[model samples]
Target: MSASAKKQSIYEPDQEGLYFPRPPVFSTVAEERQHRRERLAAVCRIFARYKFEYGFAGHVTVRDPEHPGLFWTNPFGMSMSRVKASDMILVDHVGKVVEGTWAVNQAGFVLHSAIHEENPDIIASCHAHTVNGMAWAALGRPLDPITQTACGFFGHQAVITEEAGAVVVERGAGFAVAKAFGDSKVAIHQNHGLFSVGRHSIDEAAWWFIALERACEIQLKAEATGSPLKLVAPEKAAHSAKHLATPFMGWLHFQPIYDWIIRTDPDLVD
Candidate 1:
């Protein structure tokens, strides 16, 4: 079908925009849409606050509960700090664009779609190229859980030694990433970057990244000191993870950082 015909069939075209007149309008329902908008905005703001975003690169995806095969993801070419709910695109499980105008990042779909497809428990996925996270990714050694903060990923870190280009472009890349993850929550894509999966929001991944980064930084500093590195016991690490981790704590830690993003660049909300 022609572009104009397709638009005419599904929506009323106007200067204001294509309108879905039959879509339900609700007072409280609008509040939910606004909440989704703010949550997406919060993700962008947090990325900006930590400088985790690299221009239009990297993205976060959240699954639509009603549509198991569909998800909401940041639009391609949009800065993480500038993302809005209206800017998110709904994509099918195979990475096909189902709604919204912007394109989806192929790399993001390569990694996120299979994870979402295979792991029903994972409601969200966040991928990034932060300085420390990327640095750790390049290291031959994985991030050692030396501190309490790092214990969140105590037993969940996996290293992917496969060529980065291979995973990004190949059809089996998603399966490769999923294999590397195994039963883990975090995967260290050696020489690439960090990826974290969780129940919802980018908040969990953000916390994991920050904690892992700090752990790596401390390990480096301790190495330079020429002192024997103190390590947490395996049992203790497990205990801490079970007792300390919650979606609430994840949001708490990143909200202040996001506040910084909001204050410094309020235009990000636009």
Candidate 2:
């Protein structure tokens, strides 16, 4: 065989390796579900790309805007790197699987359901155990803006200092998490990890992304200075949050980034 032919054979995709490309837009319920599946896959893929997802654990959820009682999440025990839109399962507020083939993970029942049920404005949620996020969570402290990157979380962070042991098993634990977040967009589950709420998948993903990166940066800078860290005043933080919470900013900032990811890896939509 020619050298070029051999090279072509080596580079060609196998039958099972081929993937379908995502459509440019979605216009129906099926298309929307496909979009949600793709969005969930993108969340998982981004986590894996940034090493943000917890192994065999952690979760991200999106509320069905039309069906308030149902949402999509990663199937139990799936690796964040390999999660597909087809792998996502739909579960009701009571934790029963409504649409997908897999069962709801325990943490999904305990953490996401309550957030979705209580907060009508919250359309998507992301939970993860990135090193910096875990460090702050372990310290049992709320995140503080030590840099401009942390500005996104300025006043929207809540510290859930007391998470009941085995929240998934305990009754009302989900509701408790909802209460802690209240109207805030972020929650730090002490000794556990971080949770973010958004008006859409991109919104929540951006919150988690900024919060985790900020936590990591703060910890690194604090260690270098070996001195007490200063935090922006609450009022200032609140003011910044007001601007960050506006839809225009989030869409402008995040949609382009998310669109880039979709364009580069359109198969995630499948």
Candidate 3:
């Protein structure tokens, strides 16, 4: 290949007739709503696969395309492993279950509702009590740029100290969390666990949550060794984050997981 062809292949491989999968576009709100619901269901199953479950304490939500005030979330009391698209519940900002027969989790409603309400740009949000995430959050500090994977959250992560470890069931508590979130994509609620958001798709939110949990685990394990850890330089970490931590990248990285989920647990969409 010519030099120009090689450069184009590297930078714009999907420019023309390439087979890269892109986020789907829908013609109608109904079609888009169904897509989001299925994706949310898949994310829940993905969380289950990653063992991010803790007696239904976790929640992943995707905003309704037509009705921005509402979102779809896993039913309260349902295991992430068993949640299906049809079992997902539609909830309004006021904590009302507008659709679906199953009840909504109050803690989930308080936090996710405030997040979706306060941030119009956020299309999806995920929060879970994973073992590593909880352990890291207990330290009440943000992850250091110790690895390239950790670099993804170098400047994009926040640590919310207010209401630390408190159960987020009150409206005011939820609002506090959202206020701390501001524009960051990931947050570690002090003494709680991980939270992530997506401005683009549920795939992005889900993937970021998974990535954040893994990063937390890696950092914890590294620190446990007691040797001084080498930190990535600020400039380099920022550059790495710019390219690797984008919403598009998160969505792209999730495609394989989505594919695997559909193939192995096809009933999630039911």
TM-score winner: 3
Residue 58 Cα positional deviation in candidate 1, in Å, after optimal superposition: 0.9
Q: Which residue runs of candidate 1 sit more than 4 Å off their true CA positions? A: 1-34, 163-167, 255-270
lDDT for each candidate structure: 0.68, 0.69, 0.89
Candidate 2, residue 182: the lDDT equals 80
Weakest ten-residue segment in model 3 by summed lDDT: 1-10
What lDDT tens digits, residue by residue, belong to model 2 across residues 1-270? 333432222223444545423224557777776667677788777777778876666788887646867888888887877788888888888788888777777765677888887887777888877777777677777666665556667766788865633455553777877888887777778887777777755444554555555666576668678888777776776776666654445434555556667776676766
Model 1 residue 28 CA deviation in Å:
8.2
Q: Could you tell me every candidate's TM-score relative to the true structure?
A: 0.77, 0.80, 0.94
Tell me each candidate's RMSD, in Å, in order: 13.4, 11.5, 2.7
Per-residue accuracy of model 3 over 103-153 as CA lDDT, tens digit each: 888877798889888899999999999999999999999999999889999
Task: Pick the lDDT winner.
Answer: 3
Q: Model 1 — TM-score against the truth? A: 0.77
Per candidate, the number of residue pairs that clash is 0, 0, 0
Give the C-alpha miss distance for residue 169 in model 1, angstroms. Answer: 1.9
Measured by TM-score, how close is model 3 to the native structure? 0.94
